[model samples]
Target chain A: MTWTVIGTYATAICLLIGSAFVMVGTIGLVKLKDSMTRLHAPTKVGTVGVGAVLAASIIHNFTFGYGSYHEVLIMAFLFVTAPVSANFIAKVNIHERECDTPPKPTVDEHWATLKPNGIEKMPDQPAQPSNGG
Target chain B: MIDLFNLPVGDGPGATFLAWSVAISFAVVVISQILAMVRVAVGPGSGDRILALDTMVVNAIALIVLLGISQGTSIYFEASLIIAMLGFVSTVALARFILRGDIIE
Candidate 1:
């Protein structure tokens, strides 16, 4: 049982754990209802699953001296982008139903960016009479 | 059969443990994917379907990364990147469709 062997074993175990998390996330996707709930499934899985796999790769690379942390950069990119993408899609979906208009072409500008914090704006609603009429 | 880069099958920690771990993880992923498939198939609305697809894509990317680790190859990393890029595109497209009823519009 050399150090090299032990390192590989650790990396392999990490990879497996990461993979298992991903699978659970997918199961959640199947069990949950609506687009919002489904969107949540991937976020939970992608973060930890990608993290574990990348960690495993880092360990393997360190032990074997194969590649640099370049793959890690990819993992980082995924971590940042996956959730944003999910949120974008979910937002657009919500807006479409509320507006009864076509979904906006750009979710970032039309839905995510413009959406007020906590308070929802209904475009079709008329203003209340200040005079109590 | 110990190599500087890779742990030789027998020399390092016996292939049995390594193989079993990979197998178990692989099984878990498969089962999860199956469950996702059920959701995708049974979802009541288009939005639910799209969400399921997104989750499926993420799971697929995870599987690829794990495979890369098991095989000790960088090929799977590239595939994982492609999947990541493509997943975003498909999700955006689907979301657009959900809103506008068309991808381009």
Candidate 2:
């Protein structure tokens, strides 16, 4: 009976904390200005919010003899993919000129300043038109 | 006797507290989903909408996990796993489309 009580408190507290994190992430999404700023919120969802809940799941499962580490797999997958997806989104934003002007460099042209030519060459390289046709 | 798999529902505050906490988690997940939708609808740029869409996916996964807990079943785990994979792929695809105007090279 005592162990059950401890487990319950642990799980409940974990769930409450997890839900709070999720709330913060979503509120940030709705309230933040600028596309760049908005990108940070979902990342929080991927990290703190989802992670806390999964911890609760792990704890809850222990009480039921469902001692499985499947949650670890889910966590690993999310951690790996969240960054990749965020990177892609940032890249798209840069390509689309959706972000604000970046800080200027004194010696060289900043990558953000370059206008990415569609269906063309590398991002940091100059556009080279073919003379073969 | 330990069932080694039975839920710990002794004459304690375990079950009741878990139930209430899960309910609260559900409410939070729903509110997050709504906020994500608002961002999607009013987002100024394609990138913002893409971010919002990804947030929604993560929020949905959390909800699925909560559902699994309330029902005391582990089956819902599979669905959340799949969603995680699909969410990443779709977000990348959409962002690629926006960046290059084409998905394939």
Candidate 1 interface RMSD after superposing interface residues: 2.9
Query: Pick by TM-score: which candidate is best?
Result: 2
Instruction: Give the lowest summed-lDDT range of ten residues in model 1 chain A.
Output: A124-133
Clashes of each: 2, 0
- Candidate closest to the true structure, highest DockQ: 2
Q: Candidate 1 docking: what grade?
A: acceptable
DockQ of each: 0.42, 0.62
Clash total of candidate 2: 0
Model 1: clashing residue pairs?
A: A103-B99, A103-B100
TM-score of each: 0.73, 0.84
Error of 2 at B100 (Å): 1.2
Tens-digit lDDT track of model 2 for B13-84: 556667778888999999999999999999988888999999999999999988777766778889999999
lDDT of 1 at B19: 59
